[model samples]
Target: MRQAEKRAIERVASKRRNKNSSSSNDEFEAEHICIRTCGRELKCGKHRCQQMCHRGPCPSCLEAIFEEISCNCGRTVLQPPQPCGTRAPECRFDCTRPRPCGHPQVAHNCHPDDLACPKCPFLVEKGCICGKKTLKNQPCWFEEPRCGLVCGKKLKCGTHSCNKLCHRPGACEDEGISGSHCQQLCGKTRSCGHLDTERCHAPYPCKEDKPCQAKTFVTCECQHRKQEVKCSATKIEPSPQRPLLKCDDECLRLQRNARLASALNIDPQTHTNDHVPYSDTTLKLYRENPQWAHIYEREFRVFAEDRAEKRLRFKPMKAHQRAFIHSLAEDFGLDSESSDPEPHRHVCLFKTPRFVSSPMKTLAQCAKICASQDSSTQQATIANDATAIPYNALLLTNPQFGLTVEELDAALRKEYAAHPTVKFHTSFLPSDEVVLKGSGTWTSQTLEASLTALKSTLQHTVRRLKLAENVFLCSVDDSLNVLRREGGQAQREGGWSAVVGRSTGRIRMPRDR
Candidate 1:
């Protein structure tokens, strides 16, 4: 080990001297004990070993070789230089693989064959939600397009329309019966002939546990008993020909005795005096930690109801606690996400617009703030905030198609108008390729979604326009770091960098034909 270290140091010194000597008029001298690269070709045959100079035959080529690999669709290849055994590069081109849906194409990045394709993005004409008229330009993923008209189809009540967004009559079949219906009260008469105010649905008016709560007076068919009870208890049938309501246990016992007496030739009124009625009660079991669960429920309610508190972050908790909180957040209609590595990981909930706010401080900034604090506390804080102020910078470039950053920004905004949170800026790189820098506000979607959308949009646009462009996401920080290390390579190499994108006069292309 000592000899190897000495040889490495000597090799570096020798290289430095050789580089300087070559620039001057002096002859370069070789070091007697300098280490060098083991440039032997590996078993793969495509890559050479990159280990330090050593004795005997070279080991397997452990070096990661970046080479061109075909995408999943096999229509294109990306050459970003990855390891030999690494996965194939994602194709930002139209997937040539035939889709079973019969749509012209799928709107998603090219992925492995095992992965399912995303929903189709094409617009097609389909019947409105109400099945009354045809609607045009609806997304293919939509079961039925809303016609912007009232759904006048008669509901199960046979009186009022579902009055939901105008959707196809069969939309409920696809999205479940209750999923597509409106929340209007079901005004149909109940089995007891009383009006039911429950929500409108396709199922029968009342079920076992959801019996009608209205009070009504009922008497036995024998006219021997009378009582006031819930309308549902009366069990009134829609047709009047059904058996009369038996109001109480005594009445029920008497009826059973009468039926038995008729079979045995004994008077029912005389036989019923010996029987006793039975009753039942239900008991609910609580979870193991009732107090803790109550606290969680109460905190969730406070976090959900407070309008100003758009997000809630729970302290690091056990897996079950995190799961419980996730379920609790869902019940309140808030988005919940877990961050940081396990053991210190916790859940966070977000409200409307589903925006993830920017971090208050980065890792370095936090470290500086904790300079006077204990090492363990600082380390824990840093670990728990591993995702804070994460990779927010991205660069887009498509040199082959001569696409400019301005064009990329316009295409993205045009294609995905719904995501208004991200803003794109263009700049000229030292390599003469126009690069786009995209940054988002706290309200923006996740970075993964942004990257996917960017790639999918560019690929689709280029294909439609018949342009030969290949685009990929690069980090702005990476470029900046490279520039910093090279001492502003742009200026040193007589290259120029400039901000080119502006707010005025954005070029708009004609809509897809």
Candidate 2:
């Protein structure tokens, strides 16, 4: 019987050891297993949770523990504090409760500052009523009651309050209760003749309605003055003289014309041709019409002036001059030597009918008479010798006249060879005149003979030329006598009697038998 009992006690002790060992193993596993979300050992060897560690105890285990140690205020308990004096306790509760809040003492393992706890009404939330989180214990509706959906609206204070949850328009409840009474005191007389006493919210008993007396007025169109009387609104008729204010087209035209005339240096009032002093009418026209000045100057003025000058200044030769020119034409073989003579290719030497006795006066007249002849007539001369003999003769037989320089030179050389004693110098003139200057001893007979020989040579050597009609030789004794009489009178008046005597003395008189 004693052996049986000992065996039973040994069995009981083995069972007890097995139970304790199992419990120890479970506790050890629980401690060793990682609770962090990213830990490798998230679950015990049983793989029950089958999820990563969430940086702490598993939510199911934490929930069970929270239930076990939760405060009546519905907040989960925090870790216990360290013992006093051992080290400053790391209070697990994050209570930020101020002394004025009068909150209950925070329980151990409880999060005194856990804002998400709804049961503890004294513990204000961490943020405003707009659901924003903050570090301070700010009442959700401190300024005004609002939520996230109602924040940012215009409030009674004419400003935007905190854009937080639980905030609303108007002062908060506590603020309203402190200053709820109206401060305004009315002072209005009542119908009973006594002064009424009431707050600003009460109505005044002595108010009356009155019509608007705002006066309106009208003024001149110029708006320089105003009056209480209504002004005539009949479209403010324009003044009678308004039509005369503007200048007419005719006036404008006259003004423009005057301006144009003034710019051109012309007188607008003077319509007569005498207004233009310039002998050149084309120039006068240009000055008169300033508007067309550029066109006239560029295209027409030059050509017109040239045409007028050619006509008025360079007139064709007169009949007497033509006859004299014909004589020269005959002498140069211009008239009868060739069947078709080149026009204006003739040169002439003749005595001017007006200055035969006074060669000095003939110089100016010579240019005038020469210019009157054909445009192609190269040069001309007037001699004052009594025999009407030419002392200087101009010969115009150039290449244009079909007479080459060699042919002219050959003809001249042959003539000079025939009259070797005639001491004369010959030169080619730029005016196409072959000048022949001789000593005073050369008489009309010798000059005639030399000219005849030259004519013969030119006719023979030059081709397609006529030396008959284009040549001329004439005497103007009558014309010379008239000029001499006039010159004598002028000289006598000027006290030049000696010059007159010397000049007139050279005139030969006819002797009778």
Candidate 3:
């Protein structure tokens, strides 16, 4: 047959098969040669059919609807494969858009990007940076809520304050933040009469970092000795008392001469100019006496030189001798006091109380020196005297009224003048009371009698003086009372006492008799 008749016959048969088609296969028969894709829109409005042209409805839109559905802030987003027209899941996020007032946006459901964010609803209470005032329930939009108060905080200079409004930016002295500090120069004059080379400050002294650089003339107390020193050595005006600056050997010699002249009842200048204040006869008299002021002066020199000797006691001397010794001690910068009564009166000198940096080493050296000096026969006599006392000392304490060393000495002498051999000394306690320790060759009966006499005398003295009630220092009436009250034993067999050594200027161990 011809080509035309063959084409016409195939078309007629294809139409007849389509018209009589019963299976789904016949529907796809047209799709085999169909090159056009299914362009029909699917349930997802964003994507269309992606399969080749088909005879029936397109398969469920498989062209994954990859779309980004986000909240208004873009913080929350629906990931890929999301269906078209699928509204974003309920957005539970706060708006992240920049607010005009710089405050955090309020919490709200996500909406279109074009929609404005919700207004901030937070109200805050804030204090001024200086902490002097507070703003109540300030709106969130009003950031850094500042009060009307000024920032009166002191600057680092400590002399000025930050005068800017509270809540101002940056540090108090930052130039960029319009803050300022004390810019005034220190116009105050230094001890050298030169202006201070520093800014204004609170402390009157020159700053440690910037010590006074000028030099000034410093003179001794008598103005006889002058030396140039840094202005810092001289205290700022209004406090010119600098005794240490006046410390000179010449000044000390002059002071000593003045004191000597006063003691000798001579002119100060005359005494100072004299080569020898005392004549050879007077010197011989002091040497022979052994308890004279000259002998005590020599002993005081030894005590002053010894760092270990904190205190020194001399043999009994006359009142004038003790007074001379006290004046001499003043020259040596030692504290002197006369203790004990009448014929037993003596001078005691004490070194200034100071912190010993190396007490153990000093004490060790002192012990060594004392040991080496033990070869003297006089030292042996003093040792024997201390041993003789042993524990035969009686302690008389006065609690209500304190007595000076001199007062105690006088009182003891007047009270026990009959027992002249009974040597008594006062303790070095700071209390306003006396602790008189008496030592001698005492028997049990003698000790009891002495104790009774002391009690009666003390009670009578206290009553006469009108002291406080119950002025008894220690309950020494009975041995049991003494032991129980003061934790001490008063037995004549073996009693303990804080016995002092003899007049050899050597400390000895305390002993119990």
Prediction 3 global C-alpha lDDT = 0.52
When 1 and 2 are scored with TM-score, the better candidate is 1
Per-candidate TM vs. native? Answer: 0.20, 0.15, 0.19
- Runs in model 2 deviating more than 4 A are 1-394, 397-407, 437-441, 464-513
The best candidate by lDDT is: 1
The Cα error of candidate 3 at residue 437, in Å, is 99
Q: How far is candidate 1 from the true structure (C-alpha RMSD, Å)?
A: 42.8
Put down candidate 2 lDDT per residue, 1-513, tens digits, no spaces. 668856765776777667767783555422233323343432222223434443556433111221133343444444443221221223445444443446563434334343333333443645444443343555533543233453444333332232334543353322343342333333343332222234333322323122212222333322222344311121132111211123445545555664665588853344442232222332333334445433422322233334222111112333333343343222222221111112222222221111111112121233334335533343232223332333233233232333344544555575567666565444443323233443336775676566555655544543344421232222112112111121112111212433355446354232221
> Candidate 3, residues 1-513: lDDT per residue as tens digits?
468756865786787677658555554544234446688987767678876566887666555557787776677888987655566666676555666766666666666766666656677776655567787887765556667666767765665566678666555553443223466555455554455657666445555344555544445544335455555524434233333455567667766765665687753244322233333333433444545443555575567667777667676777766666665555455556665345456665656421111121222233344445555767688655533432323344433344345654665566667566566555432222334555578764565456555656755764565442322323222231232123333323212232222224444343221
Q: Candidate 3, residue 118: CA error in Å? A: 3.6
Summarize candidate 1's per-residue lDDT along 1-513 as a digit string, tens digits. 778878778778888777777776556554444267778887767787777666787665565666667777777775656555555666777666676668776556778888877788888888865667787888888884666876556654454665456655554312354463455665555665555666655465444245566544444544444344555533443433324555566656666765665688753234233221111110001144546766776676667557687557777798877766766554444567775445556676666332222222222333334443457687778654543333333333334345654565565567546556666666655443444556666533476467556666766775566443545544345344212111112111223323223213244332221
Over 4 Å off, model 3: 1-63, 66-109, 112-116, 121-124, 168-170, 174-198, 201-513
Error of 3 at 509 (Å): 99
Stretches of candidate 1 above 4 Å error? 1-69, 73-84, 90-94, 99-123, 155-160, 167-513
Ranking by lDDT: 1, 3, 2
